[model samples]
Target: LKMGEFSNGLFGCFNNCTLCLITYIAPFGIYFVAKTREKIREQKGIDGGFGSDCLVHLFCPLCALVQDAQEIQPAAQAESMARE
Candidate 1:
């Protein structure tokens, strides 16, 4: 959970700096989420499952990344408008 928050905060910093792209950030976020879940499963001796608690913790950051990506759409559209 803390890892997810850290990843999210990092993403937010990248977004604010305009240094990261969704194409890159999304997969990295997913990878971290998977790794966290794997660690939790190992620690708890549980088979892999949905793990709603973990997902709940991760959802907000993931949503924020998606929202940030969506924000680029209007900018792209404006660029296309100018090109025409």
Candidate 2:
């Protein structure tokens, strides 16, 4: 659970100015949401439908944003752990 705290939404938003700025701006938020959805759906093995994706970002942007940022690319993460 604690494995991804560093890159999680709040951490990213606080430490990375660009992530914070894009979170609140509509045009930019769209990009963030799309990227996040891709990352989660493709990298994290999640089944993310467009409607659910939009709902998450549109309704609870903070948590949604945090969740999106909360991991390494799945392959790299798995590989690193295997090496350890």
Candidate 3:
């Protein structure tokens, strides 16, 4: 969990098949993808702007979605574990 590094590679979507499948099948999943990117930006202090986010999603939708999911998953898991 490095500050600015992605825990999962862009093509490593199968590592979390559920997320991959959801992003692939969900029609409203674009909203989810945008939120995920925002979370990554905040959590990692990323400087990439809205335009870049849009371009990434427009050009590489699935990969971007999967990567965003992979980036946020670890932090979410850790928070859930801490709650217990």
Candidate 4:
């Protein structure tokens, strides 16, 4: 699954400086929850159960966002390709 540099650990904070800054400060939980739900819908999950999900978001929040984007985007691209 291809993801934006801003969303990959290797190229994350280095590329998305502004976002990382914000994440470092706030670690927006609402955004994380929404992205998590989107990933769940795509059937690309980080693991079920509310507690684990919350822990991942509460701790490594940037990585969580990156993960959700990475998981959902590739599947979406594949589905679009299949339709074509």
lDDT value for candidate 1?
0.56
Clashing pairs in 1: none
Pairs of colliding residues, candidate 4? none
Q: Superpose all Cα atoms of candidate 4 onto the true structure and report the RMSD in Å to 1 decimal.
A: 11.4
Poorly placed runs, candidate 1 (over 4 Å): 1-26, 49-84
Instruction: For candidate 2, list the clashing residue pairs, or say none.
Output: 9-66
- Candidate 3 Cα RMSD (Å): 15.0
Task: Estimate the TM-score of every prediction.
Answer: 0.29, 0.44, 0.54, 0.47
Error of 3 at 52 (Å): 0.5
Question: What lDDT does candidate 1 reach at residue 65?
Answer: 49
In every candidate, how many clashes are there? 0, 1, 0, 0
User: Which candidate would rank higher by TM-score, 1 or 4?
Assistant: 4
TM-score computed on alpha carbons, candidate 3: 0.54
Question: Per-residue lDDT for 17-53 in model 3, tens only?
Answer: 8988876755355555666687689889988875577
Judging by TM-score against the true structure, name the best candidate: 3
Q: Could you tell me the lDDT of residue 39 within candidate 2?
A: 64
Candidate 4 Cα lDDT to native: 0.69
Worst 10 residues of 3 by lDDT: 25-34
**Model-by-model lDDT, in order?**
0.56, 0.69, 0.77, 0.69
RMSD (Cα, Å) of model 1: 18.6
Per-residue lDDT of candidate 2, residues 1-84 (tens digit): 446454465455677777567666545656567666876687667886766777777778888777776654565688999999
lDDT of 1 by residue, 1-84 (tens): 345335466447565543466434444556566566555556557565544434533666576345434655677899999999
